[model samples]
Target: MKILLIILFFVNASTVNAKTFSVTNLANSATSEDCLDYCVDGVCFWLVCGWGCSVKTTPHINHNLPDFVVSSYNEPGENSFSEVQSLDVMKNIQGGNLTTNSKSKRANSGLKFKEASVTGNPVAYAMGQAKYLCNSKIKPYMPYYLSTLDEKMWRSGLSDMLYLSTWVPGMNEVSSNKNQTDEFLKSWGSLYPRSGFLNQKNEVKTASVIAARALEVVSDGGARIYQSSGCTSADCMKKNGKWQMISPVEENSCRAFGIESVEELKDKVDEDGQYGWTAWRNYGCCIPGPGAFIGSSITGCLN
Candidate 1:
């Protein structure tokens, strides 16, 4: 009893002393990418756990067309940060309601309905998504990335972005909206298994490569945005000279991305050999790239 009590006390003490890091976006002074870069590179992870982040897009959204260029900023003034401490606002942002609702859209003029750029770096894209969650106070357990497919023929998004998972929930209710989420997961394979990206040749795999390939196909093919319903091979991207579109992963596939195998994941799964969502939240990283928010001169901590 004494030993267990001592261990518990030490654990609690460490948690209490854990440092809280924050990323700031100054109004008219920081680019969207700058905000995301801070979140991804700085605050998103402490060792392995993710500290949530978000962005205030109110300053960047404009009545004109979306901005696609990435730029820099100097510094921001006192009252410049667009604070979003409310969970409701965060949900609205994730659900696409903030930018779609007419009244809200007008009130928040800087917002324009669009996706992140498909041409940029996949790692950067992933970082941007992490920044949004980190700023919004969402804790990230598994690392995730975002990519855009910008094919000329596809005007609207076919799919917003592809999310890779580290763990797969097995026959357990992991979300409040389990029905819909499961349906999507059921159709699209629950566990991503792989943790890194795949190279252009797919021989050299890493997290960035995985994101790059997935984003390229989804953005270019426009294959049913954010839907788990099956998509045809027509949505696949051109690999080398041929098209590469993988079918939805099998349910509870529990595969790992990089060198790690399904067996390794099996070893890590809970005692029941099943996994469920624990610290996950309903989050998204999609359209509204920094270009969509950039104005003239910008300033903020891209540190």
Candidate 2:
């Protein structure tokens, strides 16, 4: 359609002068989290109208597949993935000079900004045969480059500023409060504006905050949501997803935002100011039905 071409034209024009940087090793980043929780969740039924109907067991699979590798860094066009670096070229655009640093005007107010990008994980198909246990919404090498086209919204935080959630107290925040206290142990950042800006002081946590924002932007823009429950289609479940640390500190576990602290990693600091995370999504599937799908029931379903 005409609208789609216009969008792609701007995306290509925005990143025309950017350079790519290869940071993380995709193969080495794999962890046990890929098969986090695999179990038989429920059953599916197939019917042939007037013929007959049959039921089969279904697996409630929780695959921490690397749908996307989101990178957050100080430099523009320095995306961790070499393939999609061009999608982050903002040096030639307006407000391109603004970069994350310790002495920026925003940093003076205890807030720092960074450039973030999300690209399809190259090693997403590493599971090989094991991938048959569940289905994935994203395909390998599928680019969801929102930062390229939404530069103004991403850099200036204008989009989220108009929303009511930005003004609400404790409504759109990323924090860790072990005990219900006034002060949080670790305040990752704010979810408002859904931009590449944050108030986190730590480098690792800052990268994570921006990455989470980028992921949400892409998901909201119609990227397929992971099927985490025992359902034949992703439409049957909610659109929530999780993330797993891949670079700076590779983790074998996947968790929701603000669930864990980045300080727990032994060597949590990266000198290059770059970090990557595996976007994990859950899926449910069962053996192919012989005839038309009628109805089914599942036991011990995990939602």
Best by TM-score: 2
The TM-scores of all predictions, comma-separated, are 0.17, 0.70
Off by over 4 Å in 1: 1-259, 277-303
Supply candidate 1's per-residue lDDT for 221: 40
List the global CA lDDT of all models: 0.22, 0.55
Q: Which ten residues in a row have the lowest lDDT in candidate 1?
A: 72-81
Candidate 2: residue pairs that collide: 227-282, 227-283, 228-282
lDDT for each residue of candidate 1 in 1-303, tens digit (9 for 90 to 100): 532333233334322111110111111111222222222121111122237443333222111100111110011110010111111121212211223232332323332222221112122222323322321221221112122212222222323234333233432211123464553443222213221111121111211233333333432343423222122322222121111111111121211123234353333322111111111111222223332332222332233
Let me know the TM-score candidate 1 reaches against the reference structure: 0.17
